[model samples]
Target: MTKPDLAKRPDDVSSMFDRVSRGYDLTNDVLSLGVTPYWRMRARRAIDPHPGQQVLDVACGTGTVTRILADHGSTVTGLDFSHGMIEEAIKRHGDHPNITFQQGDATQLPFDDNTFDVTTVSFGIRNVQEPKRALAEMLRVTKPGGKILVCEFSHPTNGLVNFGYDTYMNVLMPGIVKLVSSDPEAYDYLFNTIQAWPEQATFASWLREVGYEQVAHRNLTYGIVALHRGTKPAA
Candidate 1:
């Protein structure tokens, strides 16, 4: 598989995701030691989707978080830039009455402003070509006073844990990916992005700059992953 230029070219990133869509979730589960479900649960709780709420799950690969939102009684639209990912999502959750999937870019969402009660992206922001624009789009689409949840990998706070985490991410993860992932080299890029991402505080500031109010982040798994939450100010 051809590797995408992670620094530029959004279409390349989309194509990369398409190539890896078949084993993406399984690769995540394997690398994270099956802990991704727990992380998704935490993200769902942060958003607290309820009956009658309309949600947009941006970068909703394979509909994991989308299914969670729908199960909690919200009407959800799972959107991703990768067509293959959307195809898999629909195949898995098409029978569900409350959820729909679409192919879309986070930086240029295909919806009117203030359309959703909540907007979220899971483990996906770092992959976007323009993360700030994506955040702005997420803010624009969400209802005033509604929530925006971002779940992504973060630097661990504990020194000992950080050492372990770094070792796993830098070394063990790639080895594991080689055995399981459809595109093992992509994990190299994943490792680099995870390491390069801003910490909890810096990311919270980004949310605020994007016009989200009361922005905050909660560290999970000893800060290995974080769930950031913010509210869009009411008009």
Candidate 2:
């Protein structure tokens, strides 16, 4: 299926993900050189979820992050705008006792204010139509003093690393995707979005603008990806 240029069309992004849902995980693993698991582990540790806490994993593609949170004893709600992705997530982890999957938008979350102890989005925030609105919604739905974490691709600080990463994303990634991905164009869209996303420092500033405190980011893999965390200010 020919997908709209997702960077321009916010509504089309979900459908693009839906079409790629079946092979998403496998293609991602291949393209990331099997390092995504390491990234997710670092992101999970950043959250440090506790038993009995209510957590929301926004844009929780295929439940990878959701499962991590649930495994740590948090009552996790995995929310994604893509129904196909949600279906895949349920099929993979439905039997997990603490995880529930929901189809919902990031910019306009379907939850009450202050409903969760932690709100997280992994590699999904950049796809949102209005990231600031999404961040505000994350803050609104999280309890005061609760944490918000965003894990997303970022620019590499090292010149050589940046050049190599750019070549991989622009040149080699598409070839690998064509071999393994159901929708190869989706990977092209992925590369475009990653290129367009803000760097670590700018994203941390966005977190603070949305009323989060202690906004900070930890770069992983030489700044190829960043894990950002902030706390909803206690009133």
| Model 1: per-residue Cα lDDT over 1-235, one tens digit each | 3466558467777887888888888888988999999998899888888999999999998898999999999999999999989998998897899998999899999999999989999999988888999999999999998989999999899999999988887778777888998787778888888888999999999999989999989999999999999999999
Worst 10 residues of 1 by lDDT: 1-10
Off by over 4 Å in 2: 6-8
Q: After superposition, how far is residue 29 of candidate 2 from its true place, in Å?
A: 0.6
In model 1, how large is the Cα lDDT of residue 160? 99
Compose the digit string of candidate 2's lDDT tens values, residues 1-235: 3475644465688888888898888888999999999999999999887798999999998998999899999999999999899999999998899999999998899999999999999999988888999999999999999999899999899999999998888788888888998777787788888888988988988898989999988889999999999999896
RMSD of each: 1.2, 1.3
lDDT, each prediction: 0.90, 0.90
